[model samples]
Target: MYRKEFFVFEQGRPVSALIRNYERKDFPELIRIQQECFPPPFPSELWWNREQLDNHVSLFSEGALCVEVNGEIAGSMTGLLIDFHLDSPDHTWEEVTSNGYITNHNPNGNTLYVVDISISPSFRKLGLGKWLMSAMYDLVIYKGLTRLLGGGRMPGYYKYAHKMTPEEYIASLLDGQLKDPVITFLLHCGRTPIRAVANYLEDKDSCNYGTLMEWKNPFHQ
Candidate 1:
């Protein structure tokens, strides 16, 4: 693994790690992380499968990044170019990602669409996921994209699936009266949830629904 000292603050203390470009050698740990993080029917297998990961890396190498801690792959992120000008409202996750193959990446597109962002179970609470997102932001600025958008799985929704609509559940969490382990973390990282998308993925934990989230880069704006 390529190593470099990259540090970030966590609770007023400096933490050191290595953040770098994705490589085929990282696939073993990447797949392990994916298996530990996502649940059934979510297509987590493709998250780090050699063919799928290579498809994305070969298409836009710079769009993917990894975080290494203690000589292990702790986190990873992946995205592809998209054209927001031609976008329609409520696009399904399958449609956005070409049924999870990510074969629709447009090289000249103006928007950077995040396809995946995952941290290994062992690396949670270390601020690695947030750091991964920051790396993505750096790439977005470099790519000259106007904005970043993606469908975020609302894992919290499953618990109350039969009790409330996705919006109500999100509102309760947004109001700070309820807590959702996954969405709460993403919300804290500056991603804005725009609307809820049903059948966004086959994720049982999310009730097959995801929140369409966005982050507008003022630098690009």
Candidate 2:
């Protein structure tokens, strides 16, 4: 764990924490945190099931990230690298598998994508989210990927952010909610929304989601 210290003059206090890259061994812990935060988070076993992940999708590696305050998992984030040029229909696992056929719509650009990010309830309000974003941004840039893409729901919190509560929030977000806050947050760290598409899955209960955002690292931009 790497430690950093900062002084808050307004609060008249000193703050500290350990920030580090996650490992495959951390998947179980990551699942635990996700269960605590997301309504229908993925199970711990799924992280190790590459065969279960859609071929078009890439799973997070051991190098994701974790933030600890005094030695506990306060937050974690996951990212993936995808061929942005591929226009493959991004659908849920059940939807595509049920069809018995996978379609490919490769669009033609290379980009790094952020798949998930979360902070434990106790760690909210701190700069932990921003910390994860900054770390992911740097990691993506380090790989020399020209663009970064990812999306989630609006308003931030899943329950209040959407018409549906936790279930809707999770479905919309993980299942492709494609809201503006996702674009806004990416932009805050230097990203831009480029296009929108309908929900990749035709599931009746799935929220419509189809916005693809891009952020060229300023250095690359």
Which one is best on lDDT?
1
List, residue by residue over 92-194, the lDDT tens digit for candidate 2.
4324222211223223335666555678876676767777777766766676677666653344443343465534443454446544355445555555555
Model number with the top TM-score = 1
What is the alpha-carbon lDDT of model 1 when measured against the actual structure? Answer: 0.79
Question: What would the C-alpha RMSD of candidate 2 be, to one decimal place?
Answer: 8.1
Residue 64 of model 2: what lDDT? 56
Whole-model lDDT values for every prediction: 0.79, 0.52
Each prediction's total of clashing residue pairs, residues at least 3 apart in sequence or on different chains, is 0, 11
Candidate 1 lDDT by residue in tens digits, 60-176: 778778888756788888888888753465778778877556799999988889888888776786888887777777777777788788888887788898989999988988899
Candidate 2, residue 146: CA error in Å? Answer: 0.4
Worst-scoring 10-residue span by lDDT in model 1: 1-10
